[model samples]
Every structure is written in structure tokens, then in C-alpha cells.
Target: RKDALFEPPVSTFQPTMRLANVSGINIIPGEDTFCMDCRILPCYTLDEVLSAVEQCCAQIEEEYGVEVCYEIPQKSESPATPKDSPVVKKLSSAIYRAHGIQARTIGIGGGTVGAELRREGIDCAVWSTLDECAHMPDEYCIIENIVKDAETLVEFFSE
Candidate 1:
């Protein structure tokens, strides 16, 4: 069980680009459980996010035979500039169109590395293309997503 948790079989995961940075948090070391987090800032758009969500839902339905519901962050729960941010606005619009769900971005009143980076004079943004599946029993990354994210980061760093 411990080995299985720590060493997942290498997937046939072929990505179009290399990762910019990858990091993880080991919350329960003895339990052999960990959280996978990565910094792939600056590589997402609202349209792409929506399309991916739609595709994810379809895949889940077809493969797992389950209905997937998507939830967008509440306006009061997101960052203050989230709505003004192009990425956030696009995400809200795409979710509304694809899922008939009214999504909004707001401020999150919490501490994160993002805040620390800002304090240290590093500009950063946080976004995700996948459903929040960081710390599950069988956590895994979608290979196509890694490729898209790598491309996104390349573009992000170029600006």
C-alpha cells in the first residue's frame, strides 16, 4: 500500500513541452500521502479553461460513467482584481456558456505563496486547468494538460 501510494506507475504521459516548475507538499509522511502542487503561472485563458472543463466532464461521463458538476469561485471568495483580470473574466464567461452556471471571481482573504511572492517583488498569478484533484487517493495529472500548461507557461514567461 505504501509503495503503491508513493510510486505510481509511469504513465504513457507525453507532453509537448517541459514543465517550468513542479512542487509538492508531504502532509502525512508516514501515511505515504502527499499533495501535488505546481507553479504554472501565466498560461491560461478563459476560453481554454471552459473548453477543458467541458472536455473533462465528457470524459468523466464516458469513462467513469458519472455526472460531473463544476463550481466556480464566488465573487466574495476570489481576489479583488480577479474580475478585472482578463483570465478571470474569460473563465466566468466560459463557465456560464458551457454549463449554464453563473461563475464569478472575487478575493480570497488568505495567505499563500502568491502573496509572499508579491511581497518579494515577484509578479505571479494562479490558475488551474483541471478540476481540483491535488490530494486524492489516486491523484494523477492529465498528460495533455501538462503539455497545454507548459505551452501556457512559455507564453507567460515571454511577456
Candidate 2:
């Protein structure tokens, strides 16, 4: 997955630690854990992605002499919304009407409610343009964009 950099985050790892020995403030933790939010892309199967992750964990264990274990707490995959989907066309049209420009589809990752509906064969769209602060602490979007988004949605639903 050398091209992963060009894609949205198909996988994100966040490592955590549990102290087995609280000997001192400077002591190395004896146990560590990591959870991965792994999303699926058409380029690779879920099995292929997990296998690659397992291999990486194995390498870390060998290099650091630390035991490693992992589990898939949950498994869910949603089909991607095609650019030509009716829902996308309608939304794009709404955006065009609102701003006199086209709206293009791009890859985005994270837990979106649209993902659940898309899995159930719904093609509805949710979109916005914002800075990289999404999903971070105190994330925000422009107040003006909110008003514009409402206007766009009104156009979309009125169609």
C-alpha cells in the first residue's frame, strides 16, 4: 500500500499503555496496547490489510523483545459512493446552484453516519469543506459555511 499516502486514512493506529509496575515516573511501561481504526479500500481486501498489520506487530515484537497481541473488536465495511450516483449528482447540483461551481467527490475516513446507510444501499451524501482540524480537540468550521450549507441542503431537498 505504497499509495496509502495519496489516499485517506485507511488505517490509523493509536497506542496506549497500562502500567504493570508503577515503580517511578521515568520507568518504561511493561505493557502496551494499540487500537487500529482500519477502513477498507477497493484496492485491498480486509484480510490483506489485517495480515499486513499483524506482520508489522510481529516485527515490532521481534525487534523490541516485547510480546504483542491484537484483536479485531469490531468489523464493518461500507461501500463507497460512486461519483455518478444519483445522490451525489443531486448534492453536487445543489452546491453548484448555491455557489455556481461544481463539487467533486474525495476520499474521507472516520465514523460517518452515511457509512451505515451506504452499507444498506442508500446513496445519500454528506459533504463540507473545512480545515484539517476535523476530529481533533475543539474542531470547528466557519460559521458562514454553516449558513451556506443549510441553503444548499434546502436546495437539494426542494428539488
Candidate 3:
């Protein structure tokens, strides 16, 4: 059962809220509601996830005789940046100049603001040299990394 939890090929889902049955020590019964934070994968569309969730709720309602309802507060897609794009080439060159190594573009499971522009056919990248400590209590960045990243940006822009 634990393996089945992680075996799905789709995006990851984490239960973030439970509106009812907070404590299971007793039969503190009420309307049960739960929400999942879905991190979409690049391979699947938002419509696919929406359809799957709707189907799941329908099946639960049929099998359990309990009313169920759900809604997606927000949804988005982040397309991968093309490798040969001018932006990618410039950023890669700057990174090489700053670090003496080649930089490669890669897709991420997380969403980025660049996706908004990307939807409008604008070529934008969410590239950064961050250590990815976002939202953590002890999130931090090294000064050297910042300096190098600045240098890379300067090089990218100056060219």
C-alpha cells in the first residue's frame, strides 16, 4: 500500500487540509472535506487532472452515499524552454563565463511566473541560480552564489 502511494506516474498530490474529523480519538462526526496540493507534471494537462478528480469524486459519492464536492482554486501549466532559443544560449554562455562550465536547460515539476508569458507565445525562462530553499524555515543563499549569478546576468545582458 505504501508503494502504491508513490507508484503513480502522474503528478504528486499532498493533502494540505481536512475540514472535518480533525481528531480521530472519538466519533467527532461532521461533513468531511479535504484538499490536496497538486504539483502537475509536464506530461499531463490541467484538464486531465480536473477530469480525474471529478471522476474520483463521482465514484466516491456512488460507493459511500455521502455528498462530495470539489473545486480547483488555481491551475496552470509550465512548458519547457527550447534548448536552442536565444535566451537559453545567452544564459548558457553567461553561466559558462561565470563558472567555466556549460549550463543546460531542464524542466521542473514546479510552476513559474514565466508560464504566464509562455502562454502568450513570449519566450521567457524561469532560470535562476537559487539553492531552492523556498518556503522553508531555514531558507538561505550564499553570497558567492549571488555574486556569480549577478555576473552571469551582467554577461548575459551585456552581450
Candidate 4:
């Protein structure tokens, strides 16, 4: 949480496992693997989160008596884009022009491809319109959202 703004930080850990292969219907599997998606806070470093995950895995291995091998397929650093930066200015202005809504700069818990670009010293911003149906059976993108996003991009490019 930010003391000055009284805003809470968003972070999450999601665990997933898949039964990739099986020897036989009745045979017990030799091992199983799972994945952990850690969306850490901007204040924490990647190494810190990784270390915490490793510790958690170790504890689970000891408590459950099952071996746990973890790997980070990808790690991205969350860097803030200055509100006054040209890219942000253009995006904010475009959003207002396209939707007549004032866009506010904010931090997100999920990692975006822009994070990679930001880590490379490039200014990047991630934006989208949604109704919170992502990854669901009824997930979909509205046509109006597509049109609005396109208009916003056009406005950004124009100026």
C-alpha cells in the first residue's frame, strides 16, 4: 500500500498443474509438476519474489513428502512510466479524445509485454477495454471496444 495515496498494492500467486503423461491407468505416477504465476508488487524485486517462491516450495516438499521442482519460465521487471513522458501523454490524450474519459496512470499487478520493453529503457504503456470476462467460457471482446481502441490509436498516431 502507498502511504501517501492510501491505495493498496495488488499482487497475486496463481498455481496450476497439468497431468501431462501417464504410464498406465492403474500405475502410480513417478512425479508431477506444476506452475506458479507470481505477479509481485512493483516495490519488490524479482529475486526477492523468486527466493520467496523457492522457500515456499521447499516447505511444501517437506510437509507433503513430494519433490517440487520449480522454474521461472519468464521474469519481468515492473518499471513505472513517468506520467509526463511523451508516450503516456499521447496515450492519455488519445484516450480522452476517443472516449471522452480522462485516463489515469496506475500500476497493475499482472505483467504485460510492455514491461519487457520498459526494462530495456523504452517508454511503454499498456491499455485495454474489457468487461472482465477474460479466460472464461463466455470471454469475448466487444466490437465497440475494438472500434474505440482503434480510434484511440489513430488519435495517438495523428498527434
- Which candidate leads in lDDT? 4
Prediction RMSDs, each to the true structure: 20.0, 3.7, 4.8, 3.7
Checking candidate 1 for backbone clashes, the offending pairs are: 78-106, 78-107, 78-108, 79-106, 79-107
Per residue, candidate 1 scores C-alpha lDDT tens digits across 33-113 of 222222112223345546865897799789976666654432111112334566555555555554455653433333455
Residue-by-residue lDDT tens digits, candidate 2, 1-159: 433432553544444444355567898876755555555664566677789878998999899998888778777667677778999899999999988878867655556888799889897678775677976799989988888888898889989
* Over 4 Å off, model 2: 1-28, 37-39, 58-65, 129-132, 141-143
Reference-based lDDT, each prediction: 0.45, 0.73, 0.73, 0.77
- The residue-level lDDT of candidate 4 at 124 comes to 83
Evaluate residue 77 in candidate 2 and report its C-alpha lDDT on the 0 to 100 scale: 68
Residue 118, model 2, lDDT? 84
Residue-by-residue lDDT tens digits, candidate 4, 73-103 = 8777766777688898889999999889899
User: How many angstroms is residue 83 displaced in model 2 relative to the true structure, after the best TM-score fit?
Assistant: 0.9
User: Candidate 1: misplaced stretches above 4 Å?
Assistant: 1-112, 121-123
Q: Write the per-residue lDDT of candidate 3 for residues 6-42, one digit (tens) a residue.
A: 2354568899887756577676676777788887765
The estimated TM-scores of all candidates read 0.31, 0.72, 0.78, 0.73
On a 0 to 1 TM-score scale, where does candidate 2 land against the true structure? 0.72
